[model samples]
Target: MLPSGAFVLVVIATVILHCNGAPTNCTITLQQYTTIQIGWTQQQVTQFLGSPGIIVLEVGTAGSPYQMISVQYSALQSSSATASFLFMGGSLYTKSQAGIDAGVYTITSQQYTMIQAGWTRDQVTNLCGSPGSAISESGTGNTASVSVMYTVSGTPYASVSFTFTGGQITSMFEVGLSPPVNDKITLLQYQTVQIGWSQQQVTQFLGGPGIIVLEVGTAGSPYQMISVQYSGQQSSAATASFLFMGGSLYTKSQAGMDTGVYTITSQQYKTIQPGWTRDQVTSLCGSPGSAISESGTGNTASVSVMYTVSGTPYAFASFTFTGGQITSMFEVGLK
Candidate 1:
């Protein structure tokens, strides 16, 4: 059953089930992920993620004196990605993620309760972990404002975030770290899976995002890779893993994804080479490929993107640009 004003979501992700229409697609990348921040409104997040999120949990009735909501953006294309957000009065209060830093976290639900205002950054780091993933920051010197998040990796996923003014904590937030969940995938559901499906499509078909089990390569890099595991029909011990490359289903031990469907063909990829202008590559490949990671400004700008093609021997192309010209390039999982 659903609370008032809440839409149905996921067959097995949580208690609610059934939906009125096709669920909104939530396909995200590493670069897009960084643009999100705490305090953003639901409309803002939906615009960035490409659709309104399914209202997973809503507390109190529509006009109740108190209200809160928890929403999720599932099975992202970014390496080792997972996003969970909480809102109060329709405004974001807390958010968490994995694979943004490519570093392991050990923060627990128990530790989250200890976080308090006026604590020094060092005290929180000693209790949680040093150098929590920097969510956002502004200003400089002693007046600086910064927010950091610490996550508990692996089972019972959880995390905590803190905001500081000057060098002292001002506010804190956290999410997840609850008990494990049932992914609700069966052999029959698995049969419907196909190569090259977007993460959102897989989630829609399978009924949930499953657990993010493996994160390879660094965050914000072309080499980054993420694998998600779901339960099998046989038993809890028998699980399934899906590897994603560039936000598309790359592998499940069946046929690989059709990267060429979204990116360039082998012939177009070859036409792009070192020293080629960004426009030239776009002309040759039809698109510049999805920008995975980028930095700098104006003439000093540097960007990195991925171009994947179907077929064998020549797939998975990565390109780096500086000053709008190709600076470096590489490939992944050549077969």
Candidate 2:
């Protein structure tokens, strides 16, 4: 039998070797092969870890090593993240210390963890560990004071922001850079269009604004390509412009230059119904189409309606509305 001191050392070594390094006692909803043991091959890993969320194979180079597996997990209906374990010299190592450090975490049954905005934060002691680190302060009046926050950076990395109300975490801000502009909007939100009925009518029926951008058809098929641009610089310029080809919203940069050139249908004097009321136009076109741009325009304010009346070159009619009123209406055909 091993001596007491020898046994203690062995325990310490095992803890150092296998511990994920996550916050002790914090539970991880997404488990990575709870029964993982030694001598398991890559194929065995698949059967064990659910075939990995994603697999990337690359040719090995002199400096670099062979391709490895990258596993990712996501809370239900939430964002996803990657945790890569490099297969260096045929041995697996957590890609970074963050992974190993975070791996040590264990959660209790009383507390719950949430992976919001791509970072995980649990409301528990191990989460903050001890006192939080301070990060700038703002606000005034009754709710004004210094604010302290905690940051956990490592594999399964996270940032836990605590908003204090009398030194309690009244609210939380899981800090991470805002997602890429294109990623912020969904495939549908990128295609949404809005039209307003009337100011009062809007209040009566449509309480608030929440619409998605959706592509109607394939590009180069007389369909207007619609997309959204999210630039921190244009926070105040929430405007939505339309490209006429097939009623698609034009996503342009602050310079008003087209970011999606190939997607935009080239045309001169593209009929625009900008600065129109929704009630007026919806009354004409049945219902104001979809308000696509809220910060910019086209939010329950207009619709990109395409109606080709029987005629040479197909007489195309377009209407713009605001507050249910026809702000602009026009038609054109191949001359």
Candidate 3:
């Protein structure tokens, strides 16, 4: 004796109840939602979530040619919550959920501390899990760099960026919620450079320098040195020089009050005799432009330091240490 609409509602309710049966609590839990991995395919995701409410496709940025696809699904709860998964190159990249106050991805301080200058891309991904977004920059030929960003839910104003050069992590830092400017490279960007990095790698991280001086090697010699200078952000006059030998970073010298010309007085050079401790030499000539330490058999070890110098032509001071003491010192200049 019920009205037609009421009868239909009753039938729908009965069908839902029959479908659910038993305990009848069908809401999706947080644990159920987080099982999705980064490398899953669209078909796999659809199989897991049944069907998505909407699917959007857009072109990828920079290096990738594949279209980026976004699949959105509604949560099974009464709150009408939704989750969106992003896919690139037919594989999952990241996911986000709305109306979820808790974090979808978690990165601890210990994990952050584990990241180092020389870590590989796979190593970083294994330690931090998958990032929220990945950006790629391709330079001349096969050289390229990728930056992966990890953004936490509920806190949209903070993110962590891991930049890779030649498949190795060259820099990692926290950035504001906003995107970075395309042109200017900040000082924080410069801090990412490490020893033995290539010139192309430096450019990929810090952009181009203010001045570039290329020293072509002699005929038939494969070794070449390049000196790049950058004006400081705080002080326009302040400059830092990066020297690369045979296409690799050899040394870095910060701007100082002294003129670019590095000179050693005869008396000062005489004081650099053997048997001098590194501390004593450092006290006399300040710190070297760059230093490298090597371990020998037993307790013996040696250290090499490069100092910038200027004379008839450009030159560099080289000091070798053995047993923590100076063994020899010499100066070499351009021909």
**Number of the predicted model whose TM-score against the real structure is largest:** 1
lDDT of 1 by residue, 174-276 (tens): 5554413556466556646765677779978877676554444433444545566666554655556677665666666312221224466656665668888
Question: What is the full ranking by TM-score, best candidate first?
Answer: 1, 3, 2
Per residue, candidate 2 scores C-alpha lDDT tens digits across 124-240 of 445545444433333334444333444444423445444444333444434332223332222232343322222223223323221112222333444433332232223423433
lDDT of 2: 0.35
Worst 10 residues of 2 by lDDT: 257-266
Where model 1 places Cα greater than 4 Å from the true spot, the runs are 1-24, 63-65, 78-80, 103-131, 134-335
Error of 2 at 304 (Å): 11
Instruction: Give the TM-score of each candidate.
Output: 0.30, 0.25, 0.29
Error of 1 at 322 (Å): 71
Clashes of each: 3, 59, 0
Query: Candidate 3 at residue 114, lDDT?
Result: 52
- Of candidates 2 and 1, the better by lDDT: 1
Clashing pairs in 1: 157-177, 196-257, 260-310
lDDT by residue (106-187, candidate 3, tens digit) is 4543455456555677787687785435533323222455566666445666566666667666556653322223323334
Q: Report the Cα lDDT for candidate 1.
A: 0.62
